[model samples]
Target chain A: MRKNRSPKPPEPCLLTECMQVIAGAWAPNVIWSLRAGPRRFNELKTDIPPVSSKVLSARLSELEERGVLVRHVRPTSPPSVEYELTALGEELIPALEAIVEVGHKLKQLRGYEPASEAAE
Target chain B: MRKNRSPKPPEPCLLTECMQVIAGAWAPNVIWSLRAGPRRFNELKTDIPPVSSKVLSARLSELEERGVLVRHVRPTSPPSVEYELTALGEELIPALEAIVEVGHKLKQLRGYEPASEAAE
Candidate 1:
């Protein structure tokens, strides 16, 4: 009896491990929005208009827990809060850019309307 | 009255669109497993041992529907079947590679065990 033990690419688990990092409702969006710089909670809302306050709040906390981002509290007249990517989080930008590139092609192939608002 | 409409990076939506492609249980694993070449159903199951047969089957169909892969049937004795990435699907490789790159860093920063089984 032979068990089919053919060689497997080692990336399955690694890819999955990373995928989990960006794997929540609007998690990728949050990261993409912050790629430029830090932003307040309301700024994130404007950046991703579709995300609800509840989901955004949860995703922000999760990202902080993962060390992908950090929250800074400014001692302003009213303690203003902002979120920014850690160095580790910055590493994800190239990955997200690659995804956006494919996204353009996928949109074309799938016959979806091109996003008129793409900043590029 | 000022409505904060600061210049926002436009990639948030694009990133979300692409993330949808790899968003599912073992979806990225299926793509990563097939990256080297085509494989049969059982081979995929073998490549990702933790994936259930049901989830694997479902992921295969979903990927097919997304045009990330193609299904081929061989007119062999028992009519064997294989699946492979299409050209568009091949485009996702670099994206996944970038993600894997970040995965390594992320694992390190989080002090998680280096994936002992990494193919390197």
Candidate 2:
């Protein structure tokens, strides 16, 4: 005979945890920059100019801890460290794209040029 | 003849602006809560219990200012006010769904039960 299963309790709030991972001035920018590809610490710093090295490092570490990013160290002549989005992190790109699209739409509605059109 | 147009400068980063909109402890939850339908202030408070009244009001006002939600004051005895997602805000639901999916996946990888599965 098949056994009946009891309903499970709701999992601890993952949405709030995900939001915490992305909440911060530098975390989003860092994640956005990495969407193209992995980058060294210096490269990330250069790509996101307004962020200081200190803040960037902190954000990177936080993201890594959250499993959104993975750190790699290359054993070359000099050891080089790089950071890239994990599979979980890649999953967030579509969401970010959607957010960007909506943001552009809002800007257009408010009489500002949409970002994509403004890039034309 | 069509005029030759120079490529326009990249519009001020919309991604960052969008990130700013969703980046907060309560903002994502508030946005997610409205996904089903509009909610009055008290309704929202009950939906997201951990948030205090003062913080919820502040977040709702901030979301309204950011154009993510619209506040409608009902013409009633007590003048009930309801908050609903704008078109732009509705656009964010898919993104939030994607985030939640990834969040669940990450939780599973970490040996925690996925939220949906746990709810079953």
Candidate 3:
């Protein structure tokens, strides 16, 4: 018996289309950071250490244009801007979670140590 | 009340770790092709049109090195070469399936036409 997922193969175009959504430096990281809740600009940068403000700003704009996320100008005294995932953006979390699960296993298989729990 | 997957955010390194596993030009395509079953060199090339032979060969070698897939030299009359996913590679299928699912929706959401059923 074959151990494949489906009897027919998946179309390559589908994968390419989806990869482009998450493609780019720290794009996934940006999305992942917002997985928990809406985050302000500084919060996002803090969650993803070592990401320069310029690149982070650029990625936020790109994601917003892609409709994966939305920017809200909060009515705070200083008018804080927060980013949150759109419905489509929320759907990508499971896919990313699955990838993280596999990547953890792959890292151990390849003899690389997994990083300690960081979200605590 | 947040509409997020977890109360705690996912570790960024985990996503990065997994992304690296599928990183590189056409690497996901290589893995996606092998998802259905093992494929010969020419079969793979045909599956993904416009991919240069040099790039495809490099991808296979890299995937092999990363423990994602294995290459077998079939002891046929001319010794055919074939590539297939390993256990770890197989684990990535669901993640990719998720991606393809989101991608299909993303294409439509972005007002782009989805390619007609090609695998039918």
Candidate 4:
């Protein structure tokens, strides 16, 4: 039998660490879905239709490990689980919004009138 | 033999697409390093010491593919290449800075005096 041992954690590089925390292939989609409110696993799966169940689960675990999202499991007849951003995660909104702002800028710079007045 | 066909590009989600462009393993480090000015490939490799040559190359290719970073080749005797962020990529700084700001806030909320006043 092979021993399943975790490799030593990489010494988190400052900037890369932050990006990795937010940059999972499906992470931004997960966070954006949660931005509306807390969600169940199924709800998130629906929000990101193309993500496979395995990929969604892995992304959630990664986000949870980074302390970006909280997972709550309720004790009941049947288990119910939900996920939401912690205060730290909520704080990331500005950064996400900033990215959107840049996208809007790029759009406008390409000669399209900005569609969203709120971005500026 | 397995064909070297590239995977179909993921349908770019709005926010996820932007994050993925900047969220590469060593991408932020490369961007931050370039923020000082343009840099050669060797300089970037040195800036991110922990990243393997293959990983760095892959990340560079991904960023270039996304049009975030530009790669230049010089036909000198020794051959030279340099990288710099396109205007759109440089525009991502505000978002990165916002993440650092949130980190500083998290640090303070955890009861350590914020070390950086510039964040606020």
**lDDT of every predicted structure (CA atoms):** 0.80, 0.71, 0.80, 0.67
Query: lDDT tens digits, residues A17-86, model 2?
Result: 6666676667777777788777788877766778998898888877887677899999977787889998
Best-to-worst order by lDDT is: 1, 3, 2, 4
DockQ of 2: 0.26
lDDT of 4 by residue, B30-116 (tens): 777776567777777766788788988898877776666789999987787888887766877777676666655555443532222
Chain B TM-score, all predictions listed: 0.84, 0.77, 0.83, 0.71
* Predicted candidate 3 versus true structure: per-residue lDDT over A59-113, tens digit per residue: 9987877778999998988898999998778878888888888777776666542
Q: Which of candidates 1 and 4 reaches a greater DockQ? A: 1
Name the docking class for model 2: acceptable
C-alpha lDDT of residue B38 in model 4:
70
What's the true lDDT of residue A1 in model 2? Answer: 25
- After superposing candidate 2, which stretches have Cα over 4 Å from the reference? A1-14, A75-79, A112-120, B1-12, B75-78, B112-120
First chain of candidate 1, TM-score: 0.84
Clashing pairs in 2: none
Worst 10 residues of 3 chain A by lDDT: A111-120
- Please tell me the TM-score of chain A for candidate 2: 0.74
lDDT, residue A117, candidate 4: 32
Instruction: Compose the digit string of candidate 4's lDDT tens values, residues A20-105.
Output: 55766778778777775788788778678889999999998877766678899989567878898877678677777776666655
Residue by residue across B9-110, what tens digits does model 1's lDDT show? 855667778877777888878888888888898888888899999999889887887778889999988887898987767878888888888888777766
Best by lDDT: 1
lDDT of 1 by residue, A1-108 (tens): 335444667566777788888778888888888888888998898888999999999999888777678999999887878999988788888888988988887877
